[model samples]
Target: MSLRLRLNLLVAALNLGFLGALTWLLIDNHRNSIQEEIEAAHRVTVQMLGSAAQTSPVFGPAPVVMVNFLQSLGRVRANDIRLYTADGVLRYSSPPSAYKAGRTAPDWFGGLMRSTVEATVIGLPGARIEIVPDASRAVLDAWDSMTAIFLLGLGFVAMLHVALLLFLRRLLRPTEADARRLVATTQELAENREVMRLIEAGIEQERKRLARELHDELGQSVTAIRLIATSISRSSEAPGVTQGAGKVNEIAAGLYDSVHRIVRELRPAVLEQPDLAAALADLGREWRIRNPDIDLSMVLEGDLGDLGEELTLAVFRCVQEALTNVLKHAGATRVRLAVAQREDRLEAIIEDDGQGEPNALAGSGHGLVGMRERVATLGGSLETGMRPEGGFRVSIVLPLAGDSQ
Candidate 1:
């Protein structure tokens, strides 16, 4: 069964059971109380008659007194009572009579009145004869009234239970709807996360391709130009000729170095290695050599091991971008790059003691945008701001495999 239907039926059944039990108890109690009251009245009448028989003189001798007492007992307690003579003649009543004097009592009442009571008799050896009439119809009437009330109460209880079940079912509808909406939203977010990962992966591939073209094709051309200059120097022995060769060789060497540097910046060779810290350290060393006037420090605060390929690439790129920005914009003398596993998360911070402004390096270049996108894709966060001192700082945090959303 559906949950709502099952719950409704269960509630209804419990209520019905309780109502039935309560009704039975009430009806039984009412019937028993009325019967007890009637019995008590009959006992009082019997006792009063017996006492008058002992005291009254109009009753005459013992036999007459006994008969008078019996007659008076019949008169006082005969609400629907029946009587019979020694020869089984009908006698008296206390209410609307259903019997007449000429008629003998019915076969059932006559048989019951003729029966013997076996109580211990003080003078007689044999059991004494006694009479017992059927219970009063008034008792039957009271029982019927109680039964009617019980049935009515049962009907009311059933209706109330049904109403309660329906109301509870209606209340659950909104809660069920909210759960469904939450599930849908979570699924949508998961699907979007996958799409973003694919897009970022495509961008990485493109960057690698461009870097290869610059290194292989442009670097080769520069190498050929340098070799040609060396060959001219070897063959031309004249003073002016040698001077021209030396100058051409110097220019060619400079051009080759510059082209190689551009290629490396586009996509560093260290990224191809499996180790992330090594790649970052290589970038740091290169930056230090290129900017001899400024000081740079790189600290690996934890054991940098195999954090998956995508995450490693993203973190490396972020550090590369941050340092590049500092060198290009921040006129500070020192820069520090700190990478560590802080608590459960991997964190990287690039801080420089340079002229700092949060909006200073909001360049139109793809570098900063790519950095934000990469970190976001990993369920991470990146923030760039001015340090308390006169410097710039970039902080990035990415969760571990079990920790990431």
Candidate 2:
């Protein structure tokens, strides 16, 4: 069993044991109390008979008075009673079906009342003595009835506690299952993040290699081709030869332009400057120039100082992804970008007045997923939702400089 189950069982067992002990004690105490009441009743009955025998002699040895006394005692106390005469003969009894007036009392009942035997003795004229008791079989029967009732009550409580334990176990089982699933999910996410970081590092290394080849080997080859074309144009005098030389020159120029575009796309020149805001502004200006139909706005507020390089790169990349998504998906005529300092944190909000699709914003895709991961790396919060007016908004809040530690 699990530790929780073991502990629950241990607690339940302890509770049951305590309750069992308490039930036993209560039953024992109750039985003792009933026995004490029986003893007291027996004493009162004996005293009443003795007093009557001494006071009323007109009803001399009739046995009917003693019978009536025993019957009255039984009626008053809800237990049996009996009386005996001075000649070792039974004189009267109550609960008449089970007791008689002329028979010797049982040995077991005699033993139980041994201490009161002397108290019940009555001396007579013919050297005969009679013995009565403060208790009889009737008292023992009453005790048995009480014990049965006590046991029934204890059994009922035990069964109730058992049902309660089962109900408690069922209630907590689902929460335990959910906790186990959450632990597994967190572990898988951590492993995937490590793998993605390694792949990005490899991609960066390859890009650097291609940039070097384009600047060194490819640029030199293209320059040598241009020099040969120049020589051909200067030496050739025929119109057709000159026209062929010009076509070769135009092809070399086109190749150089293509190579330059490839290098620029592989890596941005502004990433080397180490100023995040400037780099982001330059990107926005370039996008605006490239896409003249869409109007873009930028707003910078508060102190944007004391930022470290790692955080700057992460913020820049997140903004770049957000803008790319906006241009591709948001069919908006206007876009607003805001970067500011709020308390000890930096805040960035990008909003576009486009045909809002909240489902698409939350969907797992390259741009949305990358932006979320980038912001999370800096221990920040990102909120993507639809604005009240009818636009899509991506808002981020990050800890500012000197506060990350």
lDDT of 1 by residue, 337-364 (tens): 9999666789999999998986843767
Q: What lDDT would candidate 2 get against the real structure?
A: 0.66
Q: Candidate 1 lDDT (Cα, whole model)?
A: 0.69
Task: Report the lDDT of model 1 for residue 179.
Answer: 89
By TM-score, who's the top model here?
Answer: 1
lDDT per model vs. reference: 0.69, 0.66
Worst 10 contiguous positions by lDDT, candidate 1? 120-129
Q: Candidate 2, residues 1-405: lDDT per residue as tens digits? A: 985677677766876787678656754565465567656765675566567555444565435554554456553342344455655566555443344334444565345433322335433332222323334444455445545765676676667667766777777567866988988887776666656555655665677679778967887788788889989989989888788888888899889877776676455554465566776687788779877888899998775544665566666667777787788888988888998867878888889999877886557677777777666655577888889999889898888743331
- The candidate that achieves the highest lDDT relative to the unseen native structure: 1
Report the number of backbone clashes for model 1.
0
115 Cα displacement, candidate 1 (Å):
61
In model 1, pairs of residues that clash are: none
Worst 10 residues of 2 by lDDT: 122-131
Clash totals, every prediction: 0, 0
The Cα error of candidate 2 at residue 256, in Å, is 3.0
